[model samples]
Every structure is written in structure tokens, then in C-alpha cells.
Target: MAIYSCFLGKNLKHLKIRLHDIKLATHNFSDKYKTESNGHTTWYTTELSHFNKEKPSLVVIKHFLPGEKDDEEELFLTELEMLTSVKHHNIVTLIGFCVEGFDMMLVIEKFSNGFLRDYLGNVKNMRTLTWEKRLKICIDVAQALNYLHSEMEDKKIIIHTTLHNSSLGLDENWGAKIEDFQWAIFLPPNNKDGAMSKITYSNHSYYMDPEYAKTGMLKRESDVYSFGVILFEILCGRHADDQIYLNGSEKGLIHVARRKFHTGKIEDMIDPTLKEEIGRKSYVPNRGATKDSFYTFLEVAHQCVAEVQDQRPTMKVVLKELQKALFLQVSQLYILS
Candidate 1:
């Protein structure tokens, strides 16, 4: 085994966890303690010792293979940079990390509700995620995007190249959050450089901009495109997959939703659960709350997924639009009740 040590300055020493702590918490990484696995990394439900007392802690421990190439190490550093730079609630919290010799590890908070992929269009949890919960989740995700794409104090753009449903996790209360930032890139402001820099990376074929994928060019709009897919999840309760979009003559959710929306049948795409809710409930002071709110949402989502990048709205604009629809739906549901 390669001997190693982690060096942290006084300011960061508190976050520097010793190897023994990890061992004690995870029982030496025994499979019995493992709760989840993704490729090479594994998640463990363990208790961390804080101030001499053990507290329940849910974390995912990412193990990097020994002797990574230069580029791999650089990518690790970039991920760390992005994690430490962010302090938003809608983004999963970075508990800490470990760097000992050739071995590396990352520890992040584990969400209780798991990924959105678990519920949207899935038989197990679909019924549990009612319309209100789904709407709240959409708002929560929008806030996260607004922070990443618009609220950076350094004026640099942090682009998450992939934003599939699996990358979105929910907390105990169903508050949605963005969990993975491994593919993120920091770029100078677009106006300063005419256009944002390109990311020569890709993953999970479902959600992305065609131009960004083909040209290695990345922009804030790339995330908008992915967010648009997420909006479809909220609207239709569908998950991202080629088959879901390619069902019948539909090329994608955007294509199908666009046609349904233009023809005034957008409600047809709503999940049966929500469809039932809207049909049975006459709580809206007016009959069109469900229709109006759903149309507003579909319109915004359709605009975000526009084939032309220039046609897509900024993250800030998307957030406000979502907020408006959320408020309308929430208010009508309560008052019209």
C-alpha cells in the first residue's frame, strides 16, 4: 500500500477527517454497511463522531483508484473547487474529503428521498409524489439553477453539462437538489469572451443541447435545456429516456409537449395522478386554474428547450416564470378549496 497523508491549514483542519474516523463510521467499508453503489463509488449509512459524540450521518464515499493520470487528478481538483465554492441549500452539502497518497475520496450528504429518477414515471414512488410535491420540487430545482447560473459572485459561469433526473435528489421533505457536479466547468463571463467556453465532455444521452453536444460548446443555455427536461418531469411525471420520448411518433418530450401545447391539449401529458386531481377538484375559484397553471408551466418549459439556444430564457428568467406558476397553482389549490 502507498503511504499517504492529508495536509490542511489551520483554517480547514476541522474539515480534514482522519482515516480512522472513516473506518469507525463505515465499519471498514464492509458491504453490510453499504446502502448504495454507483459504478466504483459506494454509499454507506454511518455515524460520524462529532465533539466526542456519534451522530447519524448519511454520506457517499467516492474512492478514486490508485495512481490517477495528470488529467484525472486535475478533474478531481476541479470538482473539489466547484464543491467548496458553492454554499447553497439546494445543492447537496459536501461533508469533507480525503487525500492520502494515491487514494482519494469525496464525502457528500446523502438525500433521503433519493433521486428524482426513482419517482417520476416509476411504479414505486410515482403515486407518493403528488402534484403539490412535484411543483415544490420544480421550484426548488429552479432556485438551485438560479444560484449556479446567475448568483455567482465571481461573475464566472458554472455549467453542469448533464442534468438528468438521476442527478437530482430530494431531501426528507421532498425538497429537490442538484447532487452531482463532476461535469461542471467554470468559465469567464460570456459577454467578456463573446461566448462561454466549451466543455469537451458528455454523458447520459437523454438531456442536452444539440449544439453543445456536437460542437463541444457549452453555455448557460445547456443547463436550461436540461432543466427543460426536468420541467417535463414535473409536468408529465415522465423520466428521461430515449424510449419515453420516442414512444410512437414523438421524437422527444419537447416535440410532443410543444405539439400538445400548441393544440391546447397540454393537459393530456400530465400524469394520471395529477389528471385525476384536476378533474375531481373544483376548488379553483375559476374552472381554468389547473389548465392555466399547467399551460404556463408547459410554455416556460417549451421555451427553455428551444432548439435555438438564443430562444431559451436565462436561468433567472426561468426561475421567475416557475415561481409565478408555482404561486398561482399553490394559491388556487388553497383558496379555491
Candidate 2:
């Protein structure tokens, strides 16, 4: 109660924005301003008029469609509260929110590169990321998770229930930020085993933690499992829900990836574009991962998607391993130059 009250008075008041101003900025949520809508939520990009800066500032507007008023309102408030409480360089910045009338909108700083999910699959609309950039992006997300899990001002741990591709966004410099926190939960530091009984479920089983699915308990390690999926997605250049992974008997990237790893055929799973970079013999230095770095990343990623929750490493360990992998790649580049 104290935690909620403190933020409600000190933060929410200053962060609240009027509905009229948002209407003006988004031109009444015009199609021209709308970037995307996935049925439940619509995203828009516009320069907020009330800011009144010399240069127009771009911001992302998330309009949560109220299907059943009570449920949608709860989700909106959960997201708002989570965003207001958490702060990190690798987490999306919440600028303001409007909750007047039927409108439930959150205004956030717009990232230049957009969602990480956009760059996945065979889509040529987005630029391909170098292995170096991918490693850095993973590191950024790992850092954010570590912060949420251990570094909160209140001695509470946050479990980001839905940590999939869509939950991650990339900035102008390809830096990654974590978003979409409506499903996140907080647990007291003294909670047994740092886990809580699950209250909700996600349909995306590909990213959902197996232990949580089976036992109805959600642990901080659940996020580690999901992050592991993202790591494999980056390495294999495919989404967890991709049709290719779904059609096979193995089903899902985690199953197929682990099988390949055990059979000593893990190299088959590396993205061809990355393979090209790795195999290149040019004297000029490039951004592809060296064998040592690739193996380091692969081993940790493999460990992350382990079936047993206890088998997975903590976010802190994941961050340390990713940093070491990046260092190995960069040091090799220096030697080559």
C-alpha cells in the first residue's frame, strides 16, 4: 500500500496528460498517424504539440482498446504502474498517459529502429543486423532484466511474464529496450525461491516458460527461459512462432535448437547471413562473430532454454556471459586489424 501510494501521488500526478492534448497530437488518432494495430492495441506516432519545443519531438502513443471495460482498465493501470515504477536505460521511457473518458493511452519515447520483431523472419523491409549489433542488443536486454530482478528501489523482484520479440524495441543506434509490462508481476524479496503462483497465462506457448505452464508457478527464472528463446531467435534469425519451426515434429525453436545442439549439428542453425560473415576471409575487419564467440553464445543460450527451471542461469549470469562473448568477438577483430 505504501509503495503504491507513494508513486500515485508523487509520480502519476506529474505524468498525467490531458486527453485533449493527445487528440490534437495524434489528430484524433487518424490513420495517417497510426503505425500499427493488432486488434487489442493500436500504436501511433506523432509529435506532441504541447511540448512546444523548437524541434518537433516524436513519441509513440499506445491506445489500449477497451473490450470489457473492467479487464482492459486493469491491464492499462497495471502497465502504467509498472512503467512509472521502473527506470532503466534499456527500458522504454514512459513520457505521459491519458485516461479520460473511454480513451486509455500511454505516450512513450519513440525508438528509431522500432520493434525487434520487425527485423525478424525473411522480411527485407528492415535492415539485417550484424552479429556484433545482435550481441550488444542482447546485452542491453540482459542488463534491463538484471535491474528489474534485483535492483529495484523497493526490495522487490519483477518477473516480466511476457518477454518475447514484440516486447523488445530498438533505438537509432540499434540499442534494445524492454517494453509491454502489463503481464509483469512483483514479488517480495523474502518470497520462497523467488517465485509466485501464476495468476495469468499467455497463449504464446513458444515463449511461455514450461515450468510455469506445467506447475502453475512463475519464477524469475521464467524470464531467463524466455530470454533464452530470444537469444536463439537472434542466432537462428527466426521467430519462435515461425512456420518452419511449427511444421516439424520437434515443433518450436527451443526443441529443434536443443536437439541440434545435442547432435553436434548446432552450426546448422546459425543464420546463413551470419554464416557468410563468419566464413568470409577478407583482410578487412567485419562485425560477424568468431567461432569462439559464437560457441560461447550458443552454450549459454542452450542452457537458458533448459526444460527444468533450476537449470537456467539468472539474468545476472546471462549478462556476464553475453559481455564475455562480445569481448571475445571484439578482441578477435582487434587482432585481425
Candidate 3:
């Protein structure tokens, strides 16, 4: 056993620890330093050494739900195994994990900017996130999902059942990375009967597809729906659950945006702050920030949140559209400057 000593606040404690010790301590430390949220499990750490070899900072820890017995334990272990196997630039990197206890804990690289939800919520001024930054973040997240859906070998379709602002983190570069893969499902290849089977159970409410919410059938398209909701949140800087439509047909932000978009009133659906920013320097009436470039981004977001799952573009297509939007925004900004 390795003996390690660290001061916890004013008290110094010494204990025999394993590799998991680092992860657990890190998790506790992260919680101590960051804001807390409901529904998801997190590890808090005071030090962030796990993120980089040189920089040590406090990090939150997240543990998979423990099962009842050894058989149940295996499921958690398998999830960790699959998550660990994934390595991508836009995806949150899993540093290490502990499966010895009834629960499985994973230590991951902590982003200083925090989750997208926190960033958007804490920004006192709505337009603090520039159009270029917003577009870039959107592209980064889409690319991350594209990698998960298409690039990984052993080729399981990773369904991020909880795709929301809270689960997306921004790194120092302002690039977005997809986090919280615990509820992810690994879909098996098409069977002889051309049916696909899903592994893992999910229970996230806000990001769940209405169809999946009603039927419990998981598919790649379900993730697309959730991603669309995330896109809506990013555009409006509002929670999907908070929006109310005039028709009273449904309450989700995406549904409302879809109706407004079809009626040529998409600007009404965007965040007023973003609209004001675009209008600030406009020389013409009705020509604020809601220009063709801006409209293109919203159209992509609209496509993502389409009512029909099949109508939503894959993350790959979304990424390309976002990249184009970002490039155009940057060029326009340069010309304006």
C-alpha cells in the first residue's frame, strides 16, 4: 500500500491509498471548489494535477452508480472500459478510474471555463460571447459528437442521452468538449434482421427525445434530437424547459423555434441580447446582427431541432455548417474592424 499525506483544510490526514485514492480525493476537492447541480454525480477536488502533468488544480469527480452485486458491478466496469477507450481532442478525456468499490469512479480533465450552462448563466451581459466564439463552440461540439458517432473503432454509436448546456464544457481556447458519458449507450452493429441493439440505460429528463421519453427506445436519432435542443439553448441562451410557445401546443424551446422559423420570424426566437449586438452598428433598419450569416447559423440550429428526427442533420453535417458560419462571421468581423 502507498501511504500519502495531504492537508484537508486545517487538518492533515495520512492514509494508505491506491490509484483510486487520487481520483476520490480529486472528486471531493472539485465539489469543494465549484458550484453544484442536481441529478448528476460529481467529484470535487482542490487540486487539478490530473488535468495536466504540470498544473495541479482542484477537480470534480464523477462516479458511476454502483450495482447491487458483482454482476451489477460489471456493468459499471464495462462502461468505464468503453469510455476509457475513447480518445479525442473535442471529447473530455477520462484521466483514470477506480472500479474496486461498489461504485465506479472516473477522474477526467477539468475545464477552467466550466460547463457552457455556467458560462451563459453567469455572463451578466448577454452578448459577452461573441458571434465568432459562439459559432466556434458550436462547431467544436458538433465535431466531438461526429467523432463519437463515426470515428471510434469497435464502432459503437455513443448516444449522449443528456445533451445540454450543462454537459458541454468550454476549454481555455473557447472550444467546446462533450462531457458526461455515463448515460451514453453503445449501439451494436446492425443485426441479421437489420435491427440495432442499445446498451446502457438513461434517465435524463431535459435532453431526452420526446419519442424516447415516451417509448424508451434508444437510437442515434435520439441523440440528434437532444443535440438539437442543445443548439437551441446555445442560440437563445435560455433553457429548453423554460420556453413557452404562443400556440400552447408544446413548451420546449426547439418546438417554439421551429414554428417561428417556418413563419419567417426566426429572429423572434433568438436571444434579444444577440439581436441587439448585431443591430448596434447597423446603418440600415431591420439589419441588426440578424444578417444572412447569423440566419445561416440559426437555420442549422433549426434543422437540428426539427420535429422529425430524420430531418435533423447528423453531427458531421452540423459541424460543417457551423464551421462555415464561423468563418464567415470572422471574416465579417475583420471587415468591420
Candidate 4:
């Protein structure tokens, strides 16, 4: 098996992991070890004993489907470059990679709690995500995006074109981390946006920025737009592809959400569990979010999905607003205690 050293230059040689070990850890990509499988890629979870740690480290191996050699190589190099250059608490960590012959894979730290989507879109699962937990998750993602858009090395920026619920992973303690950088684009210092004439399509149509879709002008605001959709998902306890939204005139959560916000019936859109009431006749265990917290979250999230790109708040602004919302909830708890 050739090491493909031409692509993995001396600088990256240390990160080039052996293919045999990954295959062994994954039992040669056994079906039982597979965690997720889309047409383009497959994910497997396993433990690697070669990290020189006291105990074996759990990891996720992302295997790319074989395609045109040059195209696959370009995609792999792009994603590898982005992952290797960044380090943040709320960003997924790339442990290493395997590139030998036709097999190409990325080894990343595996979170025990799985993707953020796992805890949403289901009534039972949504119950476990209290208002405080949800707020923290959103704050984590916002911090990650702010770092990518404004605080990268040398002041560079990364436009994460693909931002969706599934792109956010959760650790055992429920800390959120942003993952999946295959579709991200890097911009030089001081450059605000890039023109991507050909836009890559994902299953997240509801998260797509309307302005980018209309003009093919990709900007940091596009990510904010997508993050807004995720915030709504957390509020409503539903996915972007939920059938109710798809049946609407504009066919998206953003459309229905905007309509409700304008119609003064925004409270009707909150997830049923989040509407837990404290009536005098009954004892309610969880009273859900305080009015100030709910509306604060709603206001910023609504602004993020605004029709005009210029109206959307920057990630920095979004982070501050979310933090304010979280504070409202925490303060309410303290008062009641």
C-alpha cells in the first residue's frame, strides 16, 4: 500500500495514519460498526489503541465513497486542510487521516451523545432537552461560528456553507461541537465574501440563505441564516424537512415561522413541551422558558432569517443575544429558588 506522500507532504506526514489500523479498529468497515451512511460517505465508530494514551480512544472514521480520482483527491485535501488548521472547544477535532490506494478516510474524535439532531424532532427526546440545555447548545454553535468567521488564524475566515442540525455533534455532557467541513470555503484576511457560481446542494434546503440562493453570492451571513433555522428547530422541536412545513406555500420552516411572527401568533410555534404551563389547579414540574427568554431568542432568530441578507445579524451579535436569552432563563431560576 503506497502512502500517497505526494499529497501528504512532509508538513502533514505526521497526520497520515496507517490504513491497516483504521481497518482493524473498524473490523474492515463491518456493517455492525457503521453509525451513519449517506450515498456519498459512511461513518463508523471504533476505538483506536495506538494513540499512546492510557486507554483506547474512541473515534469516528468518515470514509469517502470512491469517485473520480482527481475530484476525490481535491475534496479530501480541502477538508483536510481546513480541519488541520483550526482548533476550538466547540469545533470537532481531527485526530488523523488515512490515504492509501483507493481508500480515503478522516479519523475524528467521537462524541458519546451523537449528533444534535438525535435529540430533536421527537417528543420523548425533546423532553430531555430543557430550555437551559437548548440555550447552551445554541450558544456553543454560535461561539464556534463566530470564531470561524472573525477569529481564525491570521484573521482568515471560513464560510461554513453547510450548517444544519446534523452538522452539530454533542458530547456526553451535552456540549455542542460543529462538524462536517467538506463544503466549507476559506477566505483571505479582510475578504468578506466569495463568489461560488456553483452552489453545492444538501438536504437542508430550509437552511439555505435566500439571498445566496438568488444571487450565488456566498457570505458569512449565509451561515447565520442557516443557524437561525437550527434555532427554530430547537424552539419548535422539529426538523427543517418536517412534513408540516413542507406542506406550506413556501415549503420551509422559515416561511411558516416568519408568517407566525408577523401574525402575532409566534407563541403557537413553540414546541409543545416548551409550553408547559403552571396553572393554579395543577402542579407543573417544568414551567419551560420565561417570557423574556423566549421572546429574546425569538427576536434574534427571526432577524437571522430575514428576507434581506443585510438585515441578518453578524455571528458576534447573534452570540451576544443568545447569551442574553440564556441569562434571562438562569436569572428566573435564581429568583424562584
Best by TM-score: 4
- Model 3 residue runs over 4 Å out of place are 1-20, 23-42, 48-57, 64-75, 121-125, 154-156, 189-204, 243-250, 277-290
**Per-model TM-score versus the true fold:** 0.86, 0.92, 0.77, 0.93
- What digit string (tens of lDDT, one per residue) describes model 3 on residues 1-337? 0111111232212211245556455554354544453333434545545435587654545654443444334444444555665777888866655444444555666787777777553436345666666777878888878877777776656666667777788788877888766556666653111123343334335566666655567666677777877777777767666635424444566667777778887777677656765544542222234365676787787777665566768778888888877776666666666
lDDT of 4 by residue, 135-254 (tens): 999999999999999998899899889899888999989999999898888877877556564576457777898889989888889999999999999999998778888787456788
Badly placed stretches (over 4 Å) of model 2 are 1-7, 123-127, 192-203, 277-284
lDDT pick, better of 3 and 4: 4
Task: Give per-residue CA lDDT, model 2, range 1-337, as digits (tens).
Answer: 2223444555577778898988888778899999999777899999985566677678999998878546666667778888988989999999888877677888998999888788888636223687788899999999999999988887778888889998899999889999989878888885547555654645567887888888878888889999999999999888887878877534589888888899998778788767656645542355467877888898999989999999999888999999999998888888888
What is the RMSD of candidate 1?
A: 3.8
TM-score, predicted candidate 2 vs. hidden true structure: 0.92
Query: Which regions of candidate 1 fall more than 4 Å away from where they truly are?
Result: 1-11, 35-40, 50-52, 67-72, 190-203, 242-244, 249-252, 262-265, 278-281, 284-289
Per-residue lDDT of candidate 1, residues 280-330 (tens digit) = 457424223364566677778889888878889988898888778778777
Worst 10 residues of 3 by lDDT: 1-10
Predictions in order: lDDT: 0.71, 0.83, 0.62, 0.84
Score residue 99 of candidate 4 by CA lDDT: 82
CA displacement after TM-score superposition, residue 253 of candidate 1 (Å): 3.4
Error of 2 at 32 (Å): 2.0
Candidate 2 local distance difference test against the native: 0.83
Indicate the residue-level lDDT of 297 in model 3.
82
Error of 2 at 296 (Å): 0.5
